[model samples]
Target: MKATLIQQIEDICNTRGVRLTPQRKRVYELICNSPKASSAYELLDSLRETEPSAKPPTIYRALDFLMEQGFIHRVESTNSYVSCNSCHDKKHFSHLLICDQCGSVIELQDSDLIALLAEHAKQHNFAIHNHVIESHGTCPSCKK
Candidate 1:
């Protein structure tokens, strides 16, 4: 399953006329392996230890490409990026559940909410292109 995701990312990058370099692969692998969303700085620190020659700009560029290709989703509230499990085309939407106390992030599927949001957008005469909802609160672990 993981390998398939990597291959999909590589295919998407190729379609976008971008080559998937080793550094980008490493960064993508790290994001996929991590259980939580990660910031570029966190990735940079880890990458530096593993590949001392890697620079911050390289990681940032890779991140930008990954984001543009919809290989990852960025959480505005947390200011971090998580690997997008559903990567096929650029026409998908996602909702983010973020824990305020522990900074834990979870992806939720709310079909009803999505429908309502779509209706609301239509009523307001707005063309919905990209949609991201971030709900912040304490997770069960933090509540305990």
Candidate 2:
């Protein structure tokens, strides 16, 4: 799955005419290979294992590019990031179900919910731009 995801990201970058630098690719790989969200420091630590000269700015820059390309998402609540599984699909509003017990994150997309939110925003004459919804709870596995 990790290899496939890397391939998918490479394809996306190629199709979008985006440059996938080695640093950016490594950052993306670290995020995708992780079982849960990873912090900037975690990514930097991993990068340093190979590239000792890596700095916080290096990781941040890579992360910024990955986010801009929609390859990964930042979990604002946790100040961490997760690889986007729907990157190959059309862009849409997504909500994150965060497992407080296990630190797992599940991404969900509901057109109906998005529509409802849009309607509510419209009622207040607010133009929707970007949003992040994160819910924290115990995951099914953690419940057991």
Off by over 4 Å in 2: none
| Candidate 2: tens digits of C-alpha lDDT, residues 1-144 | 888888888999999998999999999989988889999999999999999999999999999998888888899999999988788863557899999977899999888999999999999999988999899998899999
Model 2, residue 72: distance off in Å is 0.6
Which tens-of-lDDT digit does each residue in 11-125 have in candidate 1? 8777878788888888888888877788889888888888988887988998887787777888887779888867665657778888877767887767798899999999999
Q: Candidate 2's error at 112, in angstroms?
A: 0.9
What is the RMSD, in Å, between candidate 1 and the native fold over all Cα?
A: 2.1
lDDT agreement with native, every candidate: 0.82, 0.91
Q: Compare the candidates by lDDT and give the number of the best one.
A: 2
What is the TM-score of each predicted model, taking all chains together?
A: 0.84, 0.95
